[model samples]
Target: MNRPHDPAPGASPAPRATDWIGTPVTADLLRGALDLERTEHGVLPHRLPARARAQCADGQLAMAEAQPSGVRLVFRTRAAAIELDTLRTKMAYQGAPPRPDGVYDLLVDGSLAGQASVTGGNVLMVDMTTGTAETRPGPVGTVRFTGLPDRVKDVEIWLPHNEITQLVALRTDAPVEAVPPGGRRVWLHHGSSISHGSDAASPTTTWPALAASLGDAELINLGLGGSALLDPFTARALRDTPADLVSVKIGINLVNTDLMRLRAFTPAVHGFLDTVREGHPTTPLLVVSPIHCPIHEDTPGPSAPDFSNLGAGKLQFRAAGDPAERAAGKLTLGVIREELSRIVKQRAADDPHLHYLDGLGLYGEADFAELPLPDQLHPDAATHRRIGARFAELAFGTGGAFAARPA
Candidate 1:
């Protein structure tokens, strides 16, 4: 594993910078982040803030929040070349084979311009057998992009949605400045791994990212993998964040974690919405239930990993709880969907801006039959594109939940 110290075989040298100014990664230049925290190395973006993170010491939540899905470094620069150094914490299953490197996507003037990946970074070794994790420190890695248009233009370096990255340093051949806020509406979304771009091809390819692009909106994704459990802190975070459109994709995480039952679920949903409404009383708030997950559609969960394919370096998920538990108030996707629709309908009488979307509309049983989930859980790249396109049409198109109003 040699670090990428030099340019590729035929690549030209980066432009010489007599004055390479390093800008501090602050909240102003960061898009799609709800909060930022100072770390020992550098600034780390969080979907939830310090207060919210303090409430839950769950390792899963910590990891998910730090991953910075849909977050990017946005700035305007006239430089032809730009480089960013990041201290990434890459996860590795203790006994399983290593996974692929996370990708960094650079967009110029709102279009995909370049892409690259770093070499060395920290390793988070997770032992499945013992349920223990250890962090091994490693060298920081740099992602560099060269040969850009030599005119003043907007640049966005979208960090990997899957990796926990700490912004170590940024350098450019020319000076860079923050991009001013545009007239686009801000869309704030909260959900689970699917929304976090679990198996998406790249950072910008995530469903929410794609939807934001099609809707012509700014996106702040709070998609915490395996951690969207209707936590009060998360709701408060959403409540406080400024957004014109808000959405919370519920059910899948609740089902997979077996975190709550129907009895506690209704009130939790109400309370979460109540907190959000306190900040944006009239903002369009769309409640999205889980997509079609065959394993947990009618069955309760506490999903477990299927290790039968471990020898082949494949990990799959299966629902472990019984379907009969629904009678005891245990939750399932089907159960949660009904409850969510009922709750939204009851509240919409008093809160006209509130709405609900059955996630099955984005990825339903029929779609799943044609494009089966490879892991029996998360959707594949193609499915992500399909979902994103459908969501853009349903939620942001004309007369849709988040559609623009006529002047």
Candidate 2:
């Protein structure tokens, strides 16, 4: 049997028509269609400082000079009370979020309703370094809604969570809203912590947010923090959401999270797509694998923990042992880099609308080797900006496959 990294016996190239990488097309209809969009990185986990240098180009937007320089992410929320969680990781030396001040602007059906209290877990951080994980709630905040005669239409939140969000519960009695009519198109993204930005500057700075702006697609950021395991439930979630264009970024997630065996990895991926196909049979779907991270590049770690941050009774994660175990047949970035073409090839015989993109198309091993993740994990704000811009160019720029919702 060939290793997951073996060459394809007979594989064909991706369809050029579907590839808008260098080609260019501009459709005016695509702007402003996103009901919920995090096209840029908003500070996460209520941690990092809200600071972005305004360097937005013709097709790019950043605030290199804006006061409170960080961008804010406002999302529709329709609940009496909302609960938010922050993160704890092996990376950051500081254990708390920068702001911990959770009340952000709230919009009720496009109306400003003051600020909402962030409840349940003030700075909830999960330690994944000990070979096992331990989770604790940080601070609890509650936002009370009042004096509405009838059912409320939507809940909007301005975000700059500097730490990270592990779980979110929208406490709303209203039903999920119906899809708006005649939007040109919608783009859906699925991915991991990088997608989640484990303490990147903020929610808006995360690449997914920036990419949405570049493409002008109604964005559904399903980039779960530490939860893009190619799980069937997640696949079900993607399959259920309505979208015109969809993409899944896989690989580094599987490698870093240390989930699945080689045998299970590829099949799980296929199964994930299979579930998605059940819902979106013909929509253009892109499959993206991991970008480069030297940490797991050659070592193929179920990674050993780095307990340097476990301050006095402050809960330092357990360290990884030598020879980070490589249980046979499990997958790694090195493995994925070597074998992704073959895996995608097997699926191509029947699925033409499906496509594959090497994650490095945005950032590569060379980039990581030079930039290096501060926590030996997630990228810095500069890298995030770089990746977001590249993604906009290749995925949605001129030759991109995005179209705005027809209004």
Question: Among these predicted structures, which one has the highest TM-score?
Answer: 1
Please give the lDDT score at residue 239 for candidate 1: 93
* Residue ranges of candidate 2 with Cα displaced over 4 Å: 1-121, 125-156, 160-184, 309-327, 401-407
Report how far residue 274 has shifted in candidate 2, in Å: 0.9
Over the stretch 108-175, how does candidate 2's per-residue lDDT look in tens digits?
66455544434444332333443332444454333334333245455444443332332222233333
At residue 265, candidate 1 shows an lDDT of 97
Model 1 Cα shift for residue 184 (angstroms): 0.5
Residue 13 lDDT in model 1? 73
**TM-score to true structure, per model:** 0.97, 0.60
Report how far residue 358 has shifted in candidate 1, in Å: 0.8
Q: lDDT by residue for model 1 over 1-407, one digit each (tens)? A: 11244543345677666656678888889998878878888989988888998999999999999998999999999987777889999999876889888888889999998778898889999877688999999988988887688899999999999999999898888888999899999999999999999999889999999999999999999999999899999999999999999999998999989998888999999999999999999999999999999999989999998887876778899999999999999999999999999999999999999999999999999999999898888988899999999999999998789999987
Question: What TM-score would candidate 1 get against the native?
Answer: 0.97
Give the Cα-based TM-score of candidate 2 against the true structure.
0.60
Pairs clashing in candidate 1? none
